[model samples]
Target: MAVSLDMLSLLPDPLLIIIISLLPFKEAIRTSVFSKSWCNNKLFKLTTNIEFNELFFVKSYQPSIKHLQRKAFLDFITFWIDNNKESIIEKFSLKLSMPNNVSELTEKCIAFATHKGGVKHLELDFSDPKWVEYNNVAPYHKFHEPMFALPKHVYDELKGIQILKLYSCRFVEKDLLNFHALKEVSFGWMEVSIFLINSLISNCKMLESLSLKRCWNFSEFYLRDRNQKLKKLVVDNCSFQYELFRVVAPNLKFFKYSGMMSYFDIKGCPQVEVADLDFSTEFGFGGKGYRLYNFMEDFYSLKVLTVCSYFLQVIPHGSDMLRMERNFNIRHLTIKTQLNKSDYRGIVFMLRSCPMLQCLTIQLGCARIWPNYAQPFASAPKNFWTENVRIYECLKSSLEVLEVKGFQGFDKSEIRMLAYFIQSGKVLKKMTINMEKDIILSCNRNLDLNPRKFAEFLLKVPRASTDLEITIC
Candidate 1:
């Protein structure tokens, strides 16, 4: 142990600071006892992303314990914030369950991080302690809102602010708010006015990414930028009240939307490389639905695409769509939907369109691995893959990697699809199959599925490519 400590002490100061920064607030502070080398004031300077959470230390909401924990957390935070005085901080995060009246301390902490210290990223989460159990239904959880009053003194300090994330917070739009260096901003479970949202975007000239999740009290969202530098945008579960949803970003490289849009119009985004659309009934495509097809008709620059089951239901199958339009540049594809015999056609239809696809990922129901853009939520098992002979006409020449999750190994449609790919992909290099034993057992309750036996069966299947690598999990 002493030798290990000596080795750690020999690490460069910058590396040591980074190592301490990633640890929890208390754990990071305790490292001072590890060695004299770790006790330098530089450790305090390295404390950039400071985070404090009272609930993490307190087991229950007992008034006495809660009070004590809050006091201790406040003192600890104040000490560090002051210790790092006149220094620049990369991030400062806090999670609290305090009453709205006592929010002065929270504001003070923010002021210290932003006003005194140059904080580039700030995150404040004051939602319900048990917010994980809440639903998207009307009358959502109502946690006390921390009114973030960005007075001139506080707003001016945000010149270096690149990322700002807030949860269950409130803000009143004052004057022209300008975060010149802001690049990414996200607001979740917050009530923000449409005017304020537009104003915020208009000021962030260098903004590259923006996400609004479950933000309420908005009837319409209009996103139009002639000099836009945004590369990624996500608007998920936002309640626009089925009103107008407009976007006209010319430089957007990635776009994702999931919500109800009564009147939707998207134009001028010719640089978009990837797009994910989750459509629902409230999307308002009454009759003149052909316009929807026309909208996507010119996505020749799109290299990757992921569409939900509802999107597949609307678009017709066959090579006609591909034949009529310019050849797509799509080299990677992902589809998320329920798959039985009935939905197999949807997968086949989508595959026929992507002739240059090099990678394919399919996620069904609970088996969803993450959509590559967003952070993954759960550990996804890896199982069945490949396409049928028809896929040979489109993807066999270019498709190199195939990944499938939540494979039950019972559906003949799925097996045929997998067999076709394995036998037809002449250029395929690697294939991954993630199977769930529970799903197989649910299909065949009387018999258990043996992963090893299944692997043996797959190994026996003939492959078109001699160097094909297969992985089953």
Candidate 2:
């Protein structure tokens, strides 16, 4: 033990600091008691990255003493900051539930983090886990706890931050400032208005990615910047105040949205290659299928597209507007659905639309059923795939790779769907099927069903491509 301690003390100061930085903040501080050299050397004080998570300090089995815990946490942070005052912090992340009166401490910490223009990545998550659990359905703005309002003066010092993420925090439009060096920004569970969003985009000229999740208080979102450097945009479960959402970022490459259906008039985004749309709708709200069609048609340069079961359920069937001659440039298409009767027409429509599709992935599973959605899991018709099914254009030409996930042998609809693909895919080269054992047992109620036998049965099906290969797992 003496020799080990001597060797540890012999390690270079920079190497010791690097080792200490890998540990949690609390554990790193505890190294002071390991030896006299650790205390005198102050390796923990030299760490460039400081992260404090309340869960690390408060054990799950401990009695809840909110006031005492808060004080201890804050005091520990103050002590660390005092010791590391001269150190250049590259990243500062604090995840804790803040009381309404703790704004001063929060501001102080923010000031220290940006004191010398050193921090490049910063995250401040003040959301209380208990609040999220109790009011899971309500928006963050409706929570009883007051959100931490960002101090206006802090914005002036954030010019050096390249990545910023804030959760359950408040931001005033007037407090917005130019983050010239910022490359990515994420805001969740807050109320962001159109003015605030527009101002952020205009100010952060170097911004490349922006994400907003579970945010409310503004409806009309219009982003129209031609020279923008944005490449990825994600809008998840945000409540829009209007029916129309427009975007015109010419350099965007990836876009993802999950919310209720609306008229998305995305223009000038010729560089978008990947898009994921997860739209939810109730029974009475299923009439806006044309809007989805029109929205999908706008992605002229889309190379990959992903959609949920609800997206298929809402697409209009046999409508003249839906039949308007349009084709997509998508080369890869992924559909997540439960393979129900109502999804048949939509699946066919999507296959027909993607004429250049080279790869198709069908995820056979049930998604989260939103509220007021009636009969979202109804079984497919007995002869749905067999009746009047014609080989689509892509199935005969461009489609070469097919992948099916969550496959169960007993489901007749799933079997027929695979059979249809095997017979129609002229150029198909590789087919992969991932079996779900739990689902198979639950649906069949018999343990004797062998998945290998099912794979063998599929091998007997007629194939249009003589070079096709099949693998099941």
Candidate 3:
């Protein structure tokens, strides 16, 4: 072991730095003790990415320990920044486990890394458990002081930053006229206002991707981009109400919205090709019933789409094909929803819109049904297979691959559904089925649960396409 350790010291300095930089901060510092030759070497000076979290700096997970080592932790961080002041850091991440009385120290450390080392990717997670417990507490309260604040001057000074991620922190507005280097921004578990969000979008001219997760206190969100710089946008679990959320990005390409059943007016995004919408319709679905159809209309150029039953329930049923204003040029479609008898219509509804569909994926899970019992349980039209073959031309000629996950081979309905696809898919090349539970590897262990027997039984079924490869796993 000692000889092996000595051999590591003889390696080139760049390789040693790469190995050290991949480790946590404390582990990286311990590399100096490997051999006498590595002592006080350029490991600290050459390292670029630095990450500090509770696992490295904190002695214990108890919240009480936060106060005990608060000062020493701050002092150590200040010393580290000064030691690596000359290094060109590409990424710096800091995550505090608990709330501390001295929050300014963290702010200063973050500012120093961004302003001095020219860090391009900065992630700060200062979330405290107490914030969620006392969410009713006003932002001006003393407890809120522990939340890291990204002041306007910090953004102004760090003009070269391209990716900025913040969790449970505050974004303050400033005269950010020169802040144009940002290409991506993400916010999670934080409080943000409409003005700050607008400032971020308007000031960052080069931003291409933006994500908001579990952010609150904003009811309405409006975005209009004429320059087409922002291409990807994600709004996950945000507080949005009926008809209050609107976006107009002419050149935007990718979009995903997951939240309550809200009205979305996303128009002019002609370049959009991929979309994922997972919103709940438990609320009143009257005013927002037509929103999904309208939203789909704006994305006529979409090639990929993912949706839940909430989107399917809004479309009228009983037609061989869904009544759509225009057909979609979708090539790949993914459906994540509970598979009951009536839910099959939703799958066909998607197939009706995407005439150019090729790859299809269906995941069985829980589906959110309407709250009122008045809504009829719409099943597929009589002889749904004949209608599928008659209406959806893709199933006959274009669809080549079909993948069904969480498949229970014993279920009669699931087996029948699979058989219909096999009989109808004329141009199908590959069919993959993933079982719900692991089958016994040894036949002696459990004969009935053997996967080989199951696959053999499925192979006996008739297939429309002669050149098909069926894989069971």
Candidate 4:
């Protein structure tokens, strides 16, 4: 009695499918070749991720593949399905980079997905203009919506696809008319209407995670309809007013945004416990107009907060940022510096306010702004980075494990700050720097000291209070 493929697939799941993809095909399908019931039907159960990327290379472009030929790329997908029941396919991704055949390929893909069952996750990306359309500029407004034809019954037909990710693809208002089952959606392009996006989300009963990046066309998009099922959302580099997120996701757990849209009204997301914010504005941050005190009200359950910002140009002085007077209740906080000078004080204030903050990552840098025209320069450059060391020194009280990056060897201000950390960083558990040993000892210099004395000086610190680790990188 020959044990058949059905026996091999008797205990099959996502893990088994992944294991099968890794094995040599001949050996992988040996169970199928053994017997009949173990035959074609059950062999494919241990399978997932059918990628048709092989059908799209530049050197030998398959002309008939896009023409819907009997043996086209989708045909291969159909053959794979016909040979076995692909009930295990969780993610069906297609990234074709051929020239001017995206529409044809797109049509076949949608047809295969609609006709074939079990495709719950789909990532359809035609980011390159050459593959999508033969023009110099892609018709960004039309790709995604057209990928899957406007069906008469989208809710009924697409009841399976849970996660939909489209990059450089178009999403029309009518597309969302049927995407009620969609749980997570991430999309990017030059222009996407917020009104259209809102209409889509309004109808998305099960939609959860929404990430929009670099979409400058329409500025104001609001997720204020607090009754929806959206749990996590991230908006990046879009110029919308701060009033959008005022309602807060009562059930939301993780909320993050990176860009100049600083007017965030957090009163709404009362339930959001974790937030990652990067308000490193290129134009400037702070001014008498900025309402930074709005943050003082309450974030009762906020356990983790990450703040990334650029040089503060308009930070409200004497406010929470510089004064450390505000009250915050987070348990773990990380401040990654995307700012130069102006943004530094605000960050210092944020860390100080978080009396309960346990973990922190203070990085350095600024946000880049893309302008419609060339910028005009008139004023002399201000030295903002000169205060970076001082800011680090300010953080010595709470920071237990300090990791510094982008360090230059032997700068006086930097050394002074390090010296302060060596002595005043009493709470520090470990110090990690990207400089060599010579650089570390430069902090405590003796006029006639050798390397041995320098090493000795470091050995007598407060019971290994300063555990120094140096690396070239």
Candidate 5:
């Protein structure tokens, strides 16, 4: 049987280029051998995006041949760029290792992408590929500094770029200038000074989203721009030199922070609609709980709130609960926590604070507990859900949906918590219990009970909402 080789030839050049672009870099280049029309300059010159990854070339090779592979990779990219010099690339991504002498090559690549191609999205990841093989715990600090430093003149060419992501590359802060077309920027595993960060934010007037992850060398981060156009900001696992962190973006909408708890002074961001707080450290200080409580008051306009188990455990309870005078405008609240004795007071505090909450989601067994000061998982009292808890306004009126994710069938505390919500949530419309498959396997091995029967038993529980529907999956 003869197959039709002319089928690909019937498609338009733009469509063929797109189809080839979706393939792996090696496979994309290999398509040129199929026909002369699909050669290097003919079809690929119209391609708007290109990604060159060094790991892709060296993944199957031994460590000794990696240098030769790197050379070949460089030559191939150089040849490709020589052929497609006139093409306007929309996105250019290069992930490779940078030794001491590779700055010139890096600069040339950046120049090709920015000055020649007018690339809008550029990502240059110079992080060591071995970092991945070592479970992302490679000793990056042992290298003392980032191997590659972005040249000062490169900032001028980056003005047209809309999205830029740099990993393990140093920046010359003094050379930074206005990026008029830049909208989103991300920095990972790099040393960012406070002045440099502030300067970037000030200069990138059109920047809408900013993310910093595992960044070091900056202590006091202050985003005090009143007319800032930033809409979303994320700071994840960044090591700070000091404890002070503040933000004053007036037009900011979404803010997510995940790291050690610090002295946070988030204010002036009245337009914030969503906030995620995931602290890895345990609350050990005297007034940290009070500080967190006061910190939450700054996000008055927040509609969606996500908190971790540590956040719940740190909330001040007992007499301190009386100090919570502000009711959050959060319509949806997601708690990524395990149902344990330590979380009871914090859960109650959150429920009381969000009176207008319309949706409540409890994600179980996903909380990151600090290794040094992990809290014990003790069972709650028998009357804990009934007599100990007060009827919150959200459950009585505003709350309509309840979702329990990562549900482990054997936890009595979790079972009681679900029952409490079913019986108290008067306006509730739906309750979804998403079970963990591993939990089901364990239950089948240890107990004689069927999961369906257990689900049916839960359905038989007395519910306050007459129109409520329960779904178990």
Candidate 6:
């Protein structure tokens, strides 16, 4: 029952189309007039949600779609609300690109959804830049304000929204408290101002989950209150001021992040269950001050941990890896890095740290480079870790399920690393050598290490009782 110009030509007559589209139960009456053979209530009912995806494009000569005139936009919106006044929309969405300056059309859509109380899920996608480029949308100024940057009276009409998602749309402090029942909020690639941050804390009282990904400018966030019923919080890939992990959510069940020079200062929430902290360490950060050590204090109840492997050359200055001995309650640990250099501190950290550490999947690299000052790792001072990584022979004590992705040759460093795992992980169940094809081709073409020989050397490593699995891709 799509309303289209061709719909009239497809049917027998104009009067039939008018009866089919404009009247009450118009479809039923139209089908009755169409010899009764055209009756299909199930199809029409099912198609009710099938919004006409009326996509029109002008390729050769881009049609300057007459700018959505203010009057027409308002009238069309008013008509929709007037018609569906009794119907409560479950999912309300609008993707019309109103001329950049005239945000009134956009405002009307928001106002309509606001007055309509049944909107449970709402999505307002600002059109993609390329689409605008193709369409020749003139005077297209970027949106750097909240989706509904209207006056208070405008927002007064909006209420009862649950899940609100805004992508690439700026949000101001005032936009925070607009939705009283807002549960889940997602802001992608948008700037979050300090004022807006505080507003969210005070306003979004029932907010259960919040994710700010790639949205930048504000860094080092401090929650206004620690106990805001929020269960999950995720902040990833954003460039913000370096702040220690300072979130006080006693009810927070999950906190995940992927960033630089960061640390977590959890408020001891027993509810936090899983943390995907791909946090960088000193080694991961080219031997900087401390690789987000302040974060070691988090995860009192963390059950899952995924750590990025340190770059193999940068040596940590202090007792870098030792401090991590007791912090993690990880039952599953995935370490991503290689023994590109004789990074003993890193080796020991991955091999030994997790006392309760069970499932271990090591995405290691074969490219090895030892520090010029590096003698046997143990020769370094007690404060100087990587002193003797042979101690990794200790990992065999409890580690099981070892998956080494990006495996290359059995270089001396890798042999040493592998030997440690074979000896230490006595309880080891399965050891896998996941090698990439590029590694073999690179060795053959660049490093000149015979792939077959290197692989054979790795296979011969002594694993007392552990079953080994080698997979090359």
Residue pairs clashing, model 1:
382-433, 382-434, 383-433, 383-434, 387-420, 387-421
State the C-alpha lDDT per candidate: 0.65, 0.75, 0.68, 0.52, 0.75, 0.53
Model 3: per-residue Cα lDDT at residue 463: 84
Residues 1-473, model 6: lDDT tens digits = 97435343355543453444333333333355344323432222211111111122212233444233434544555565555544434555554433245476566556555564556666565534333221111212233433333335434544676777665554444655778787887775457764575567568787888887656666576654444688888876555576554677778887787665445567555568777754342223334324444344445466666655432223233346443535467677765665443455554554455567677776654333422334224433222322333444335455666776666654555555665666556677677766665755654634435767766876777765545454433
Candidate 2: regions farther than 4 A off:
1-87, 98-112, 130-146, 151-153, 281-283, 318-324, 367-380, 408-410, 435-449, 466-473
Off by over 4 Å in 1: 1-5, 11-15, 18-36, 39-45, 53-88, 97-102, 129-153, 261-263, 280-292, 317-324, 366-389, 409-413, 436-448
Taking the tens digit of each residue's C-alpha lDDT, what string does model 3 give over 1-473? 34344787788888877877777666776777776666857564566777766445556557688656655666777777777666667778887744345557676667666667377888888876444432212111222332666655676567788888888777654644355788988887876666676667788888888888767667688877755788999987665433478787877899998776556677667788899987553453443445566666677888998887666666543232365657788899988755554456566777776777899987655434554422235445344444435536788778999988766544456666777888778888999987644332211122234578767767887888998899887
Cα lDDT tens digits, model 2, 198-269, are 777788788889898777767687876644788999988777778678888889999998776767888778
Candidate 2 lDDT at 397 equals: 87
What TM-score does structure 4 among the candidates reach?
Answer: 0.64
Residue 370, candidate 1: Cα error in Å is 22
What does candidate 6 score on TM?
Answer: 0.60
Model 6 ranges off by over 4 Å: 1-117, 124-158, 217-220, 241-245, 262-264, 267-271, 278-291, 310-316, 319-327, 342-344, 364-394, 406-424, 432-461, 466-473
* lDDT, residue 150, candidate 4: 27
TM-score for all models, in order of appearance: 0.77, 0.75, 0.76, 0.64, 0.78, 0.60
Q: How large is the C-alpha RMSD of every model relative to the true structure?
A: 7.0, 6.0, 6.7, 9.4, 5.6, 11.5
Model 3 residue 337 distance off true place after TM-score fit, in angstroms: 1.3
Better of 4 and 5 by lDDT: 5
Model 4 lowest lDDT segment of ten: 372-381
